[model samples]
Target: MKIAVIVQDGFEAFGLGVLTEVWNEPYHPEDDNPVFDFVVCTPRPGRVKGPAYDLFVDHGLEATEDADMVAVTAKRDIASPSPEVAEALRTASARGAQIFSSCSGAFILGEAGLLDGRECTTHWRYAERLQAAFPLAKVNPDVLYVDDGNILTGAGSAGGIDASLYLMRRLYGAKTAATAARRIVVPPRRDGGQQQFVRTPLGQTEADTLAPLLQWASERLDEQLSVERLAAEAHMSPRTFARRFRDETGTTPLQWLTSQRLALAEELLENSTLPVEQIATRVGFANAAAFRHHFAATRGSSPQAYRKTFSCCEEETAEQAV
Candidate 1:
């Protein structure tokens, strides 16, 4: 595949680094994977300064002329997208190339009118600005990325990795993307709407008071875990523990606990042959009715339905083992 990554002055170094690392890294020859021909392109085809360093590009915007996919790296300056860069992007899109952007690169795509009337996402900090600037574009700040067929936009920073892995999944397959993610030490798939890092005043060490308590609670989900018990586990007053927990996790203790329980319930549903009532009991839910309600609320599906869909693969594997 011919992949062209567009770079420019003030472009984010980390976002571009993620792209280059994924596309440029040569796989082990014994693996028999197809080689991806990757090139860095600039508007002027010369020296371009990124956020952290300078790089010289051998190809100009013309490099995208024959490319199958064109990825725009994030820019530090989202307020203004250069006219030349906008035109190049529009031209690339017009040529039927799959267009993608990371972080604030959505602004460039918006300026080029490619993102008009399309669902997209940018950094949460810039979601309001992007929506105001491009009213026609549907800006979803909650998502890590949005793939609207030909044009894909990633939220921010690590979201670039998510978007790139999604592309890899589309071009290759889930196993291939998973392998690449293992090589790079990143999760293969983070659902698009997963929340980004929350802004908080507490530093890591100061805020991590409830880590052990959380781990303990996760292990004992089948047991009742109330505020008093959680506080005791953390060796703090209930009020203090609740306050500190919210500060560090950006969510209330109960909310976090509910999410963890839901996750555990999901795994149990997918991997076990136990009935809904049994799974509910194992995951600490009071009954099958309560588990069904919370599972639907958090996962957008009934417990039985989720199990039915996800368990198929496991069922196949079990049969193959037999």
Candidate 2:
């Protein structure tokens, strides 16, 4: 695959680093992992100064024309990408190439009219500005990244890594993506979204007070848990407990518990050979039917299908052991 990463003057070094980390670096050469033909492109093929240092690129705007994926790294003066660069991005998009942007690069996509009416995201600090500047684009402030088919937008910093790996997972299989993630010391998959990283108004004291209860609940995901039981454990009435839980966790107790269970189920499905029904029971679901319904609704796929698609364990090995 050919990957053209468009770098402009005053570009963010971390953004370029992530692009190179996920695509340019070969993680498992012994296993014959796919290697991308990665090249840095600029509006003018010459020395461009990034925030920390300078980089020289021989490829110009034309480098993106034949690329399978064109990524716009975050940069300063984001609202004003050169016309040649914008046109190259638009031409790539029109030709069905996968287009990606990290952080403030969403502004470049907006300038190119690629974000119009598309569900996209950027850093939380710039979400409001991005939405205001491009009213036609739906900027989701609470997601790490938004994959609107061919056009993908990532949030700040580490979100670019997540978005890049997600693209790898989509192109290759989950095992291949997991191998890359392990090599880089990042989680193969992360649940929830940017909401997990948002700083809440809750005081540290209040959050600390609920730490034990939260830990206890997390450790017992295989057992049925209820608001009443949790409230009793915390020595508070159900109403007060529920309110305190919301204040500390930024979500309802039931919702928090459900998300934890779903996360555990996903881990088990990916790494273990447990049957779907057995996995459902172990995750505290009443039965396989309820598990399937919730998994389908939340993850957009049946548990069985998800396991089949992402499972890293071998079926023949499991069958022989059984």
Candidate 3:
């Protein structure tokens, strides 16, 4: 993939660092990770002021024209982009290139009219500002990110990582995204629908130690593991476990399990030749019918359809054989 990161004066170093970590070369984000053609550009090919330092950017906005993806790193001031930069982005988008914004970079995108009529997000603090600025845009403040097809916008701080990994998964497949995430030491995936920030108590409670239980439950997806069962295993009362789970994960136990199961199912669909029914059972669904219901609800596709699109081995399923 050819990716160009656009930066400007006052660009948030944290957001830029996160974009670099996910995309810029030498990290080997996939088996095909070596394929990234990364570039950095500014509106002008000269000194650009960051929050703490000045960077001598070598390339100009012209570089975005032929890029497969153009990422806008956040600026603390949320200023509008230069005419040259905005034009370059719109030109790239017209040619079917992906456009992404990390954190408050959505301001630039909104300025360029890309966010108009699109579902987008940014730091919760700036969500109202963004909406007020771009009246036509649908600003979803609660999500970590919003994948509006060609235009992907991330929330504040860690939201960029989530969006970047999602872009990789969308382009390269689940295994590649997972590998890149492991290298970065972040969870493999977080639903974009997940909260921008958890509203849990600031301090960790005794029952907040749910990592071991989560891992254990993930490994035992084939078995029936209810909240009570998980609570017993965690040595906590069921009520305490449920409260702690919600606090720590920002989701209920059943939602988390269903997400985990679907994630595993995605990998199996891409990497294995298992039948749909068997994969369903292995992922803790009571039966294929129930699995199909949840899969379509969450993934927007039936299991067979998902396998057909994402299967990596180039082998045909029984459905494809007909």
Candidate 4:
């Protein structure tokens, strides 16, 4: 597919780099992947510089005219998007090309009037400004990204990675996205909202060691795990452990534990015939009432509701197999 990446002065280099690496990189020879042609476009054709040191691009805005998708990179300045650039985006969107943005790039889409009445996200730091500017748009600050079919927006820097990977999953499949994630050594999918990371400090020294503990906890969600017990397992005092855990991860221990338990409950709801009370016990909730409360709070629906909504398709597939 032909993809056009919009660029301009003072654009975030890493955001642009992530898109380029994912869509423009040569695929492994064994897979015979289709070529994804990426073109860098700017308002003016030649020698446009970015916010990063000594990085300049040499493509004009006209490059987007024929693209199948337009990916807008965030700019250091969000106050003014050139009329020409905005018009180009409008025209592309009108013609049915998929539009996407990372971080402040959502501002450009807003400028083009593409974000009106749509659910979207941007870097949390800028979400207020974006919402204030485009009063018609629904801004969700807690998500890693918002995928509204043809138009998508990511929350922040690393969220750009998540947004792009999700795009790959939608276009290709789970297997292709998994392959891409394996190459980068990041998880194929994250379990919770980016809010889990907000307001928490990361521990520098203990960061790498937490991955194993997280995996172990995920597998044993049925057991009661107090902060004291978890701290003991990590070989640290509770206060020190909490601080380090928050530092290493961007969330509190209880918040992380709740997220994992909910995830496990979701899986059981979709894949098994276990009663709500049994599933609640399996995931360490004291009773079905507690499970229902937490699950509804996190997932916006009760266990039976979630199962009723998600189980139909899976059952259909199973019946087809039979």
Considering TM-score, where higher is better, how would the candidates rank from best to worst? 3, 2, 1, 4
Per-residue lDDT of 126-201 in model 1, one digit per residue for the tens?
A: 9999999999999999778888869989988789899888788667755567668887899777656566655454
Q: Which stretches of candidate 3 lie over 4 Å from their true place?
A: 26-30, 79-84, 201-207, 234-239, 316-322
Question: 136-223, model 2: which lDDT tens digit per residue?
Answer: 9999988889899799999886799888888898788777787789878998766425353434465667777788998999999888
Best by TM-score: 3
Worst 10 residues of 4 by lDDT: 196-205
Q: Identify the runs in model 1 with alpha carbons over 4 angstroms from their true place.
A: 29-35, 66-68, 91-97, 166-174, 201-204, 221-229, 236-242, 254-322
Runs off by more than 4 Å, candidate 4 = 54-58, 204-215, 222-255, 258-322
**Residue pairs of candidate 1 with colliding backbone atoms:** none
Alpha-carbon lDDT of model 3? 0.86
> Positional deviation of 37 in candidate 1, in angstroms?
2.9
Candidate 3 clashes: the total is: 1
Judged by TM-score relative to the true structure, which candidate is superior, 1 or 3? 3
1 or 3, greater by lDDT: 3
lDDT by residue for model 3 (21-127), tens: 88874844335564578899998789999879888999988889889999988886765546777788888888899999968888888888899899999999899
List the candidate 2 regions with Cα displacement exceeding 4 Å: 27-32, 192-197, 201-215, 231-250, 314-322
TM-score, cand. 4 vs. native: 0.73
Q: Candidate 2 clashing pairs?
A: none
C-alpha RMSD for every candidate: 4.4, 3.0, 3.0, 5.0
Weakest ten-residue segment in model 3 by summed lDDT: 25-34
- The local distance difference test score of model 2 is 0.85
